[model samples]
Target: MSLPFNNTCRFNSVFAGVLCTAALSIAPVAFADDGSEASRERALVIVTSDSLETQSMAMILSRAMQEQGSDLHLLLCDGAGDLAVEGYASERTVAPRDIKPEGLLATMMNDGAKVDVCAIYLPNSEYEQDDLREGVGVAMPGPMAEMMRDPKIPVYTF
Candidate 1:
């Protein structure tokens, strides 16, 4: 017996998730720094959530990491990509400092964070590459996947 087309797709997605989780679990751990040499921690922060609180928290945590000397590569997808769009402002402000996600994003970029939107963002959205703020780039899947698979560079998704 075979699953219906939609059911097959759902099954494939779930199976792929399980395999990826298993592979990650077995991948050898690589510390960001070794006593013999000095190296900053590298991280890939992927934010695809549309929720305001989620977006805010992602940026907050990323900022914390950067201040600690970690090298950050931000991959903004879905609605979160708007944070890179020039002249775009978030609706609500977050607590503790009363800054929105876009504000934190700007601060990180100023501090030399590498920020990029998923390549599909521009084509699907009403924005163009020119719409993005200076220093922001579009992420290509090949390079983004290489970052994700690098054991030394941990991936954090929200």
Candidate 2:
């Protein structure tokens, strides 16, 4: 016997839910490959805020992103560029562990995150190349623009 109209709709909805759940479970494996890192996830994190709290949160999230296996790329601009400066430290510290944003930034860098200062950071600021941390580089607009436009990679700004 055929089900009533409402029952049929209910059955269809249940079927669709199960189908979606199954697809979601397999989606991550679909992006994996054999021992190649190029296929791993990528994300660009831009920090331009001047607020200590904002900078603190940005570094916190960047750490989480790195921990999750994303190839984290950091673009520091404006006041946030201070994070790349050697010996730079914020007056206040974030709670839980009292670590400053600058300290957290260093930790993230040591954890393999790629770091760059915006192209104008040098010309607009008194700090020179020697002032920047050892591995931090000035970003080239050409490559940065390309990465920002890529569909598979996401960009997060704070």
Candidate 3:
């Protein structure tokens, strides 16, 4: 079963690519005109995993988009789902900077970003609703469906 290269890196890259492709495939079919009001306030939907680098990047990107006046919605799933658990983000993934993903998530929340943990998180993980940090909510299918159907919003995965 041994491979010539690092399997972890290979798996991660392939997984990331698949996720990105799925996200892109669900893109809204319509878009607001260039000068329209809707075009001015675009929304960003981020589906993130538990990878430290991915979480950090998603948070950083979310913060940047927020600064640009975009509404941010973050969906935490799989390993990334752990970030929603209170006091769980203890490891700092980014080196030299000492910034933790949880901290960035909190900043996004403070900036009015909507943070949601996947609906199946509790059933699939060892966490109860109370274990989730304050302000983190269980993602509902209805709203997510709407977001995916909205052409004005851009969906990204990390």
Candidate 4:
């Protein structure tokens, strides 16, 4: 006997097919390992902001890179140096609000990520050596400039 004329079944079947196709398309990106991403080897992220949101996004990206087993180096230069200042805190409540730079520095250090502050920016700032949070290192502009030139290193400036 033939099936009843239920157009709903045809629609449901088509919908299911579309869902399966979408799932297949996305599954590889979601579950695939980072070993195949050649660019994941080394990454450099530059944060030039003291903004909460910018710092937060940088931290999140750094964490993701580390999770993928990439060597991550974060450079804080220009206005971003404010983040490395000890006791620096922002009271702003907004979309770009993020953990204090000092806090992010500590977290990144704990996660085996390197945190560097531009020396050129340092001398001009009010931050003394003692003002910098622990586990953060000094990076001269020369070295940072060179690192930024490396083709393999992906630079994200904020």
Candidate 5:
């Protein structure tokens, strides 16, 4: 017999939590660099989701990785591209947490993390580089391609 829909949803929620926990636990170990040429502690975070939860998680994770000596690059595309716009208001994702994703992104920038929106974002959205917040750039194809080809750097997507 099939379980009720709500029960199935609950089960899925629990499963997703388990997966998130497992992924977090494994992330550092899997990406740690032992000062080796082949394994540098660098990360590329590609965020295509504009949803508050997803962007918040990406920002949080990227900051954590930076704290661990990983150089981080945040590439925003699709819905997430809106995040790079200057003075863009962000919806709060976590309760009892005042900082929104936009604030977190600023903090990350202050920490020297690179932020880039897809090159097409501006043209397609009728935006220009000057329309973005300071320090945010358009992701050029050449550098983006190079980043992807660097096997030593791991990528996290949200």
Candidate 6:
């Protein structure tokens, strides 16, 4: 005894199998999360700046990094600490071309980037805790150092 099917039914079954195989072959590539090239290109940026030009450049770089879906973390030290403090940045500087570091820090925070000021700098300087601008967090040297050590974390100092 033999099982038999019409030519039309045989064609339909073969076509259906081909469609199923094609769909399966294409589905994984479409939905797989194997850490593609785009994901591998993601990075962490650490900006340390005490100069007005450096601070301004850091802000621009942070904005561009965020636009490209990279992570940015800023550590303010030395005179850069002044950037994290309120009013000091604005009141102390009158350079005609100087970009207010405080404002740049604020914009960075608003963009979901993390801004950290050296804890040692906070108390030694005249800035009070409240004087530290909004969205600025305090970090000790150790963690900042560790972050800088990561090969994937690019450090820019100015």
Candidates' lDDT values, in order?
0.91, 0.92, 0.80, 0.76, 0.87, 0.70
Local error of candidate 1 at residue 87 (angstroms): 0.7
What TM-score, computed on C-alpha atoms, does each candidate reach?
0.75, 0.80, 0.70, 0.65, 0.72, 0.62
Worst 10-residue lDDT window for candidate 5 reads 32-41
Q: After superposition, how far is residue 144 of candidate 5 from its true place, in Å?
A: 0.7
lDDT tens string, model 6, 10-115? 8899999999999999998897756554343334444455666666776767677767766667777777777777665554433565666566668767877788
Runs of candidate 4 with Cα error greater than 4 angstroms are: 1-40, 92-101
Q: Is candidate 4 or candidate 6 better by TM-score?
A: 4
- By lDDT, who's the top model here? 2
- The reply for model 3, stretches above 4 Å from the true place, is 1-40
* Candidate 6, RMSD to the unseen true structure: 9.5
Candidate 4 lDDT tens digits, 84-150: 7777775753345434555656777787788888877778987777788787788977888788898
Residue 78, candidate 1: Cα error in Å is: 0.4
| Models sorted by TM-score, best on top | 2, 1, 5, 3, 4, 6
Q: In candidate 3, what are the lDDT values of residues 1-158, reduced to their tens digit?
A: 56746797799999999999887776544442465445656665555566788788787887888788787888888888888889885565597677788888888898788888989888999999999989999988898879878877888788
On lDDT, the stronger of 4 and 6 is: 4
Candidate 1, run of 10 with poorest lDDT: 29-38
List where candidate 6 sits over 4 angstroms from the true fold: 1-49, 91-99
lDDT tens per residue, model 1, 1-158? 45598899999999999999987876645443552323777889999998888999999999999998888999999989998999988887877788799999999999989999999999999999999999999999999999998899999999
**Residue-by-residue lDDT tens digits, candidate 2, 72-157:** 89999999999999999799887877879888889888988999999999899989999999899999999999999999899999
Candidate 5 residue-wise lDDT at 5: 83
* Per-residue error (Å), model 1, residue 136: 0.4
Clashing pairs in 6: none
